[model samples]
Target: MAIKPRSIFEEVSETQKPVAAPGGIDAKGRGARGAIRVWLMMLFALVVVMITVGGLTRLTDSGLSITEWAPLSGSVPPLNAAQWEAEFEAYKQIPEYTEQNAGMSMAEFKVIYWWEWGHRQLGRFIGLVWGLGFAYFLVRRQIPTGWTGRLVFIGALGGLQGAIGWWMVHSGLQEGMLDVASYRLATHLGLAFVILGFIAWYTFSLGRREADLMQARRAGDAGLVTLSGVLVGFALVQILLGALVAGIDAGRNFPNWPLMTTGTGASFFPPDPFSLTPIWRNFFEDAGLVQFVHRMSGYLLMAFAVFVWWRARRSPNTQTRFGFNAMLALMVVQMVIGILTVLYSAPVQIAIVHQLTAVVLWIAILRARFLARYPIAQSIRG
Candidate 1:
């Protein structure tokens, strides 16, 4: 038996191929990967809810009610009359209280107070959801390779957005300032959209296995990929402009749509667009100019969307074509909602609907872009 070992050398006539790298097999197609993605998708939905609530706070003029950022303790609202008075006293110090909402009763104060508190509460909940989910996956070693950094970056952005929320509120507390600065509000909203876009992108990327994604990458369409990027940039600019419109209450000012009007007659540009001090301030503070720019940008966005849809119609992949179709339909509906929002002077219910549609439309565009980058395979049959 011991002498039989010598036969090993005789059997080694053909050298053994090196063992394949460990775990080189496609484990990416496993269920754990999909589970992590589902967690992220849940976080995405929560953030959307947070945004909608924030919009309500602003619409109800409740953004300045909290007066402070208590990341931990502020979760609980006032429980007693004395505590309520303390909160009300802090509010009274702000110009929004002394000048705009002067002499408001306690009951009225409670209404706006609840709206803002709810908004902040939702933000905290979203952060908790993201942190817990990320931490769980990270501890379990369930996060996919190259995704740890992505998840951590999202948490960092969420933290920054919270700080920015306080910063925006602080602006409105300044002497004689009735609301947050338009630029600041735009920054806050822009970053939220950025976070949202990243989530949407990661969600889309995780929908397929690594092997499939790699294979799809080989057949990627560069033209559509480039156009989708352009579309995102184009849409972001329009979104910022819309933020400006919201900040300055410009929508209420231009109640008549398709054309802006003077107090006495009709005009293309807002009359006296340069009236604000320092001329440049007009862009940020001028309602007429901001509203006019927002309207014009909406028009341009619509035109570009039409072009993207036309190109998408030529895509050979059925799923890719459908993605583009959904995006185009949402864009068109968003345009109509934008017009209606202007015509009706941005009533709370209607404006909220417009905003919700905007979130959906944004997600749709992201889906189309994801498809463009890594198109889904399709059958040849009709």
Candidate 2:
């Protein structure tokens, strides 16, 4: 065989294709992004349902029905006749039972007791789902790099939320108290949204590969990001304010729109808006004042959302723009729902619907904010 002549220049001139450093965990199929995202979506749905159920429990004045924070044994509600009477007797000691529902029949007591029991049960279920999913991912060694901490953080928050739930319930159990303190209620609800927000942001991030996210982030709109962030803050504040309103049943007291009246005449503020002693209590306990603050905050939030949507119109990404559009549209719908809720005196059905809309709007705002922070890359034709 004749030996082929090799040019000395060939060795130096030819470029070597470097190995791509084994890609990343994603390329190795270790990220489990899709599986984790599905798990998060499940958590998201459950949390939404939890929020709605919690709202119903509050509205029905059933939150204090159980009068106990039994995380483990409480799961198995009153099973027999004696057990039912025992539970009812315990509830009868609370001011809510003694002062508000004093004449509650066993059947009537059962209804509220079920509401509270179911609410707590749902919380336990959520915690279970989170724990099982987290363990599965951890045991399988499939959690993405840096994500184990995030997942653990969520679990931690869930635990803290349970504690806060008990704290809120304990408030109403105290003497002379008819309902949970408004501030405590707001704190509990606020944490729920915070947990939801983290899940949502993680879910959005996991939908794409980390490399793609890094690349797309380079093209994200800074102005829109800032604006959307501000809008998110406003939306959350409005939501907390709404919680305060619900906490005190303020919406039912102020049925007049465009003006909060004592039902006989139009007035901008509630009657004796600051009648509560110590002055500060008015912000939380005074129906007229709390509802008024919620209303004004909604107006400001709506206006800011409109401004953000207008700013989003200038973004190059179609999906990002669409997200903001949905956000603004939902904000409008939520506002209208709020008005109707007040007009109808916060009836359980209408009030629950209003609360559900707030959830949707919240997710919408978060979706838009995510798009702003990590926009999808698009061709110039887009």
Candidate 3:
């Protein structure tokens, strides 16, 4: 007699035993998303701190003290007096030492060396954190599908940033060069903003499940979407201009409000603006012209932020409106910090605060844009 074929339904019901509850995604999926999002947020905070530290290093005239990349060996730093003297002697050979800080003592040299070293050390730590966490999640199969490439892209950019940092520092070491090239500084900072923006967007995307994001798309406002995008692009340009200003020490040139002019003969425009050769080079190298552009850009950024805020107020989504409101507030505060930074001649304390405020503004804009793209659903009664 032929063996009776077991009933398919009976076999499935008895042996299959739920096979992951019918959906391709399971509860583990949500846990993984949450874990990854938290990890990204931590990285985001680290980067923000790193940016602030980088600014401080620049402000303190410490960026050029290291004079070497030495990515792996440099992490240990100088442990003995002889080692410290060796490091200081090496630093004395650079343009910044001979030209800008000729009389600096070994004690002072140590001060700057630590700043640059700390900045690099923090970067190394960030890389370690990202690498280890990513590998762990990937091995455990916790990273959600379709996200491996995006995650990998962030690490790649981060590694590129390290190289860019070294490149920025090298520009200062060349003969006759007192500081990093303004354009290279701008490039390094611009890439930082790009990385931060991507992290913010990714963090936002991960906050909600895939299904939730799909469902919320219908409710997203087109006007808000366009306006938010415009604001983000506008903010990035302003950041670049700000970087140009900082790179050239433009903020210390005029130290006036409402324009580049101050005191009795104060005028909004810089006097004798065509001092730089190549004509076009004045925009980046000339302190007077660079600050002039930065001031005007500030005005434009403020006006544009207002326009976006005005449109956002009319959005039906409460969260979206509140987000815009917060962004507008940050824009105002950031403007104040920028002005204060200028008036104080870009003092180390004030300048660092100004940079941190910029980071806050940058995050605020990203969050507002995220809300525009994936607005929170309000109750029908509200």
Candidate 4:
């Protein structure tokens, strides 16, 4: 006798049934895991937005407006004219206002103050959202075993980011410097990226069990992983260089691309890297060399991205291929933007877009690495 074919619903039901795990998560657990992953992704996107807005604040030279850090009280902006004048008076005492923005009115102060205020407000919002979501997940017991610690660690890092922001600001306030220290800027941006990467990795780790199995099956590509890691490293270095360039206003000096000047430029290489004396100075000071290094780093990053794409094109997996192509496209666009920003003396709009693109490219490469490492399984139907 011939057996009847199973209905699609039956097939799906069988597939969806929880598989016994040797200390691994079950089907019900997987649903919760997916939810957590979504929450993390959303949080990560918020962080990216914060970074973009922070870039805008920096570009507009509005980062130092508030001139004070009152984590709780600062969340509420000025409510009346008296409050506004009080805040403006505080800003006026800063060397930035006395020496650079002398005679600036309260209304003008409000423009920059609002941008800085918005940035800080966003940070607080993110903190509240994360705290509430995490607490809810914890109380519900939906948070996976061994993951709570990591979650708390990330939360602490967020707190640290707040502290670091003040520390960076303090550098400028104490020395009467108009701009923040390059090293502190690097530290701040680096931490932001680290938090971003952690969230991305956490999200990827929460994929379904079937997806984990697929990843296990295709885990022999060591070279690809290494290459991807190197690309990520390259991108990060480029970010640091860009930060330094911004800190020193280096882009203002070099308005030509592919060459330093209109015709044959000054020597392609500085006679002595030590010309900037005190190794730290070369990294943060010496505007000409800093800009030159940033430009060269961009070229290096583009070349590396292109090479990665070329190799990925030969991979059997469609996801890896797509990732490689996306990285290539992003690199090219980023390079063009970098050149344009330099040529045009880092116009605010273009500079902000450039910073935003860096975040986007960072996320894209991260996602690509994740997919390559953890290929998802196709659902089986009877």
Candidate 4: segments with Cα more than 4 A from true spot: 1-25, 28-31, 210-220, 262-279, 377-382
Candidate 3 TM-score, C-alpha based? 0.91
Error of 3 at 335 (Å): 0.8
Give the range where candidate 1 is weakest over 10 consecutive residues by summed lDDT. 22-31
In each prediction, how many residue pairs overlap at the backbone (N, C-alpha, C within less than 3 A)? 0, 0, 0, 0
Looking at model 4, residue 32 earns an lDDT score of 66
lDDT of each: 0.87, 0.89, 0.88, 0.80
Rank by TM-score (best first): 2, 1, 3, 4
Model 1 lDDT per residue over 36-149, tens place:
889889988988888888888888889998888899999999999999999999999999989899999999999999999988888998899998998888778888877888
Please state the error at residue 225 of candidate 1 in Å: 0.6
Which structure among the candidates has the greatest TM-score? Answer: 2
lDDT score, candidate 4: 0.80
Query: Candidate 1 — what's its lDDT?
Result: 0.87
Runs in model 3 lying further than 4 Å from the true structure: 1-31, 262-264
| Sliding window of 10 residues with minimal summed lDDT for model 3 | 22-31
Q: Cα miss at 230, model 1 (Å)? A: 0.8
lDDT per residue (tens digit) for residues 1-382 in model 2: 9999988777656688887774464575447999999999999999999999999999888898888887889899888999999998998898887888888899998898899999999999999999999999999999988899999999999999999999999999999999999899999998899888889999999999988887788888888988888887887888899999999888888688999878568898778888889999899888899999999898888888888899899887899999999998898899999999999999999999998998888889999988988888788898
**What are the TM-scores, per candidate, against the unseen true structure?**
0.93, 0.94, 0.91, 0.86
Tens-place lDDT per residue, model 4, 1-67, is 9999987767453457686776453444443677788889889989999999888888888988988
